[model samples]
Target: MFAVTILGNNSAIPTLDRHPTAQVVTCNEQLLLVDCGEGTQLQITQYRIRRSKLRYIFISHLHGDHYFGLIGLINTLNLMGRTEPLSVYAPPELEQIIQLQLDCSGTILKFELSFVPLLPGYSGLILEDKDLRVSCFPTQHRISCFGFSIEMQKRKRKLIPEQAKAYEIPAAYFSKLQEGADYQRKDGSIIKNDWVTLSPGKAKRYVYCADTIYDVNLLPWLKDADMMYHETTYLHDLEDRAAERYHSTTVQAASLAAAAGVKKLLIGHFSSKYTELQPFLDESRPVFANTDIAEEGVSYIV
Candidate 1:
């Protein structure tokens, strides 16, 4: 059940048909909001996402398009009587920005809110829960931005009931066997864990490369991901303009995905100038065959 739903796929400007950057990463029953752009709360409702299950929020940078919706979303949660604590991970300066907005409005949240500042160039594991592990890496953007790598942890080994029964292991110990525990029979003989259980499968990873210019250093983080979201803010023909704006073009993003060997690539954060998105796909597919447009409201399985 690990998947990411695209909320707003467009770049800086909110067009009539497109919004800014926002996404909902669902890991089992919990949801992690990534980049709360303007109208994100409305987008969440429009997509029928369970906002109550949201436990964490990650902001990539100080860009207004990436986090302008934060205060509004937080205020809405409070108005809706949400009680669960919410944790936000973002740049150190965001704490003051959010606090200023809250203070000016004199709005006291009904739930606990915690902030974990991501200092400049910080990279490594930022969060680990029972179902998911998330890490952040710096990206080359106009501001200090970050990319998130999310891995869904498969904690339990697969148990073979027939093998367990043949070993005369009690049914009550089945859970323990699934947890990779070896069993000691009454006769004091050991049944190795591998005899009855198989190792957990490789974890599924989803990497989100927030706004960034083409950078090869990200290969380590992007390599072999089950799915990756990379911004393609302009078409290939606009390469010069994209570089000038510190953004990526379709070909640049697709080429990187191809080099990284990610299972699939999602390209979004389109510039408002492009009314039709087909050109983006037309330009990227040749470079990366598995690339897909990160269309709003579509949930791509990790």
Candidate 2:
């Protein structure tokens, strides 16, 4: 199943009830770490996420809130004896920073570490696997930042058993029908593939709007998403501060999600000053009915 798990949902400073930005996107058998904030490794352990299954790590920006724990996590993976090649997608400077830390410690990684830089102001498809596709887009932040879109593709065409049987196609060849293959009957006539099979359903997508201010230009990337994660760094009452800091308020996040016609909206990146999260939900739900708090330790199925 394709889904995303929230690890550290808070913004800025870390608290007992809140954490920095971090998420785990599960694509079939593979696990993708969206952002590696501090304490993210521990959160993975607490959530029973299989670190061995992790294949990629995506750091949206260089902010400590988003990737302070990346070096530690990578070191832990090496110490855990992981031999699989792991790829990291982030700004170009991240590779240098991480390599410096590792070199200073005189530590050698057991696995191949590959880095794919996310160039500033550039946006396009970055990764494509058999089951999922990932892309990045620039976000309005103090420094160069980005957002990620994870789309789970539908590969298998729908098989209509009754239609195939009516055409005298044997059940033994049903697998071929699902693969959109034409069938040959005993009568030496070919049955058109489309007569029996339909197109696969639309793909499901999850968009992570990393850390950004209110930017409507993101609509093209977030169009009709199945689920979206937008940072709501403050309540509506603090909209001015949010704009100044290049963060978004709950109302702003919901408005974008609603305008894009996204199926669901998950808001997080709450400021440390706020303890109660109900205000965020109250403000967002009116704008977008499917809005929910991006609660830590919770997995939202996309």
The residue pairs that clash in candidate 2, if any, are none
lDDT of 1: 0.95
Return the top candidate by lDDT: 1
Can you write out model 2's per-residue Cα lDDT over 1-302, one digit (the tens) per residue? 99999999898899997888899999889999999999999999989999999999999999998999899899999999999999999999999999999999999999999999999997999999998899999999999999999999887889888888899888888887888889887878999999999998999999999999999999999999999999999999999999999999999999999999999999999999998999999999999999999888899999
List model 1 lDDT by residue over 16-107, tens digit each. Answer: 78999999999999999999999999999999999899999999999999999998999999999999999999999999998998999998
Error of 2 at 188 (Å): 3.4
- List candidate 1 segments past 4 Å from native: 168-172, 186-188
- Clash count of each predicted structure: 0, 0
lDDT of each: 0.95, 0.94
TM-score of each: 0.96, 0.96
